[model samples]
Target: MDRDAVRLTVMKHDEPWAGAATTTGRNGSVPHQVGAPGALAESLFLVPTRHLVALRDVLRSGEDPEGVAVELGAAAATEGIGWSELLRDVEDVCRSVSGSLPPYEVVRAMSIAWTETAIHDAYETSCEDPLTGLASAAHLRSRLDDAYRLAERSGVSASETAAFVVVEIAAGSGPDVGLLRSLSMLVLADAMRTCFDGDETIARVGEHRAVALVRRSDAIRGYRALRDLLERAVDLPPLRVWVEGLPATSDAATRLLGELGRGASATELG
Candidate 1:
């Protein structure tokens, strides 16, 4: 199938007959009807049959179908689309299904689901460490940007709410390289959850360094948590370490991560 053509159709639903309902052929792309008032009905024909089934199940289980549809549609989009139009589509679908789910509930569920799905996908694809399940540095930036934007929109300065904690883990001496790396990951996961909570953003940028972004107010507490995690590192013998605190400035944060990468690779004490 021509992905480009299908992508084009996904983006522009301007024509009344350009959607799934209007196009009927055995071709891989589903036929859809494209129009304003009937957009939801058209969308049903456009989404893949399996996805449609999953969507139906969500609705049947007392979930908001409109919200589920918005997430599923956005999730499936590999190409770019106008954010305004996408949001419009979501609003329209939610309104159409208002009878099944409360209007406000549909709005809330879809908004949250959209955000959660987007975050999870971004972390999975761009920000997770394949080796140990820690977040990657790029993902760290994305997380910070999202959080900072949220704070800023809510009338808080970006710097007022965020802090960075860099944990430099010294590897074990001798031939216990594998054990050392495993220990580092364990320490990271524990420190992340205990200090920053499950919602906190943490990342492993190098073999010997992990960084966590915490609430600015929690800087001291976060540091204490790191200390505890490091103390547990004694199980790996030489895999001990010192911790450092840094402000989570957007630009400075990037530079700090870079410095950490170089410093951790060097023989300097943390």
Candidate 2:
């Protein structure tokens, strides 16, 4: 196809693909190469083998080109479908992308990525009580390591810094243990999000606790800001939280999280 014809005729099922074509084709030139797809794959942050098959399926077909093309374009349209139908193809595409690679390796990488994202998102959504996410204790362990690395890499280590803000929420006797648990998670999530930055991390390590890893040069101000934010975060039901501060030592994150978890249990009984 000529440059104008290619621009007009090539249908893009993914926004990232369209963006790649447009961005790479600027200055009146068509990319004229498969490299565009590779670049698009990189831009979307997709691991090539993980997404290549799925992306190709979305844009190509076998003998029944006309029929498949029509279906593809229809799926790309924004309307005229049941909710399930709308998502069904997209889900298939994602699965195909993830599935085509060597199953064990792809699954392993995706599992790690998925858990990391889940831990971060869960901490963001239900921070008041980290345990509400019911994440495996191992997830918090991983996040601690992640936080430690982030702090160490901050590039401004000359200044002293508070490494983490840990919160332990203990359930009281009569508050529906479940509701209090739920409330605690909400609060924990809030507290974590409140304290997090691009370089921060949050995770849950106990049945009723959460913690955040922060890198603030001014420890007192960071702690105060976090404390005040949690104090005003009202979504969570009544509960007692013990907050602690720790320096961003080379390996204090796990110990801090462990302390918060144990403290929550002790505080609950006391």
Candidate 3:
């Protein structure tokens, strides 16, 4: 059989939040209608019989379908698609047409895709500071907790090796000073990237206070880099910076930050 123009058409069921029906095409041609809507008001999609047969054969051949589903689910999740619900619907369609349960992997993939999509969406819309364009204090604290948990699960010594550093900028209050502070944050963020790995989390916790979580080994280097960056920028007004090291734990970090706000001395970096 000539297999050049086969395609799958997926139609979404009508619901309050459901988007307009979309079609997936192959051979650069629009999909043909399959049949009328089912009794459950589910839209009918026309999938190439050859593709379905191939997928069934692949499952029968002992391929790990669930794992494949998971990989695909993660990709779909990144795209903000509901993988699990879509998977259930696909299973229903497959059962109706093929008269057999869709492979477990197929169902699993959809579930994973849905889960991933939700997680990515939440992270993308998380609270962040406007001036520095970094995570907010609350969001940073939550991220710190998550990092700690992952490290614990992986048996890594992040708690002992990680360091939290606070960078407080002291600038005079004035219209010009406000503009200078904003510009300084941009420079500070760039300098921080040079001092720490790309994955380090930096956030503005207060008007003049920024915090960074980095490896203890890199804390001194990061501080010195930041100090140099601020000192060398002669165009900006003289801003006093006090860098301090705190415990990596969320509670301890928060407490130390509070103390720092109450006039803690600057930590001398070697």
Estimate, for each residue in 35-58, the C-alpha lDDT of model 2 and write its tens digit: 442332322212222233334454
Residue 241 in model 2: lDDT? 33
Clashes of 2: 13
The superposed Cα distance between candidate 1 and the true structure at residue 257, in angstroms, equals 2.0
TM-score rank order: 1, 3, 2
Cα miss at 112, model 1 (Å)?
43
Cα deviation of 120, candidate 3, in Å: 23
lDDT: the better of candidates 1 and 2: 1
lDDT of each: 0.54, 0.44, 0.54
Colliding pairs, model 3? 65-105, 66-105, 69-109, 77-117, 83-110, 83-114, 84-110
Candidate number with the higher TM-score (1 or 2)? 1
TM-score against truth, every candidate? 0.44, 0.38, 0.44
Total backbone clashes of candidate 3, pairs 3 or more residues apart or in separate chains = 7
lDDT string, candidate 1, 72-145, tens digits: 55554422223343445444444454434335654555455556665645654676776567788788878877
After superposition of all CA atoms, the RMSD between model 3 and the true structure is: 20.9
